[model samples]
Target: MLRTNIFTAWIYRLQHTDLSSKHTAVIAELRILLIDENRQRAESLTSALNNSRYKISHLASPNISLLKQVDEIQPDIIVIDIESPSRDILESVSTLSNYNPKPVVMFSADQNTDTINQYIESGVSAYVVGDIQSERVKPILDAAVARFKAFQKLKVELSDTKQQLVSRNLIDQAKRLLMKKKNLSEDNAFKAMRKTAMDTGQKLEDVAKTLISLLNTI
Candidate 1:
């Protein structure tokens, strides 16, 4: 979390460092998608973002084919600037998170805190309210990317931890079932499980689960 805060603060500083130029070299050669119903606003954002050497694509509105468009474009980051973030729009953003899972920047003219939290939970890396500026684009994009990566790493770690717990539980359950059914000692039961796993070329957890399932059927 500290890393996220420091990275965000650094980006903010980068945005204000040079008032004359939109310093964007940090995010050069990156692909960006701009989703806005308002064509003028989209164009303005595109022009602003383009100055920083980022590739920009525009989506006029959220459609059923939004995911397909995303797959085709393969944007590194997604930028959404809408007057009001509608349900359909939010769903589209959620779908992006579920499917491609990129850093998303959502710029809303105004919104309540509840709706903002919903957006953040649903996958908006940076939820900005009020006017969107050209100078802040590069920094926000970089910060969003950093935050997304950190969150993704945490998610992967959590998933691995959960799987490990499940595996441990399965092994313990298998051992008890062995003791109850075969009258085997705990050490012998574990040895038998390890031996079976080695013989079948399967993981110990998988072998344990399979043995437990087989015994339950008998």
Candidate 2:
């Protein structure tokens, strides 16, 4: 019975796989900047993408600076199809990562470990080591979008956590200063800061910073 149940589940998945994977009907509602040296390949990929979902723009030349193009186009996502990425291409992507962050999908033939690592570090969200075909475009794009969103969420959380830590350290420093300057207990110093924050409609950290500055000047 267990074997039969397993077989039935496998059949169910096989039957529904195509239906579940198809994304043509769903609207992605994003602007995609496609960078492809080969015009023929670019057209093929554009045709494959859901017209209702993606607003597509193409850059047929390879030598143009990608950062400038991206700044002008301001696309939500970028897709690059290249045989092997050059140093200029990697540098452009790295600059884009620092300045204008967007999800990047690269379809490249080069599978060298160092090259792939460079691409990742340069902020390529999805890297495919094969031909850029129409049939595979949607799935690859979906994966790229998902990965990009997850990564962005983690980055935001990390930033918030770091800021909280810094604020906490500053508050602690201010509290220590207040305790020493006024000969107040730690609890009293914290209460005084909190009261000032509430009265002035300022944040506790802001009040702490002000207190620290004032105490230091004296």
Candidate 3:
């Protein structure tokens, strides 16, 4: 009886763990902004995308107000159903692209080659034309999100590399000063610098900078 009870408890725990893992694997709810002059079309598009993983909000207004709505909603994706590529629409999206975490997709019913080229050049992540379908929307959204995340990671790495280079340069300069002032070898100077850093609870780079500043003043 004791063995049976232990097995049952283990099985229950295993099932619960599996369920939690599955839930976590599902992407977080995405916020979508639908901009279209045709109220009916916007409503239909919103309904189509209302799945478990997406929380869509929509706006059916003139092009001028659409920009304001986008600022307020701060959507993960913006699906613009353009019948014609109006100058105002293009300008608004162009301005919005300057923002961090820009919108993912822009769609239109009219598929003019020149317009498509312009949209791509303007930093729009993905473009689609004609009646949008579920099959088309999902893949584009996935790619856009992936691309934005990659850009963010690259930016962070670049910033970190720059800081490290600056720190190394400062340390090198400090070591040279110590060798000149104390007649110590490079390794010994570094050791003394490290000891100073440990004693003062200051970073090695900071200590190096301070040493350089003092040397400069003299």
Q: For model 2, what is the error of residue 75's alpha carbon versus the real structure, in angstroms, after optimal superposition?
A: 0.9
| lDDT of each candidate versus the true structure | 0.71, 0.70, 0.65
| True lDDT of residue 99, candidate 1 | 62
The segments of candidate 1 whose C-alpha lies over 4 angstroms from its true place after superposition are 1-28, 51-53, 61-65, 84-98, 111-123
Best-matching candidate per lDDT:
1
lDDT for model 2, on a 0 to 1 scale? 0.70
Report the lDDT of model 2 for residue 142. Answer: 62
Pairs in steric clash, model 1:
none
Candidate 2 ranges beyond 4 A from true positions: 1-27, 62-69, 82-99, 111-123
Give the range of the ten consecutive residues with the poorest summed lDDT in model 2: 1-10
| lDDT string, candidate 3, 50-121, tens digits | 674666777665455666766777777666665534435645565657754555566656545223443432
Candidate 1 residue 164 Cα shift, in angstroms, is: 1.5
The better-scoring model by TM-score among 2 and 3 is 2
Clashing pairs in 3: none
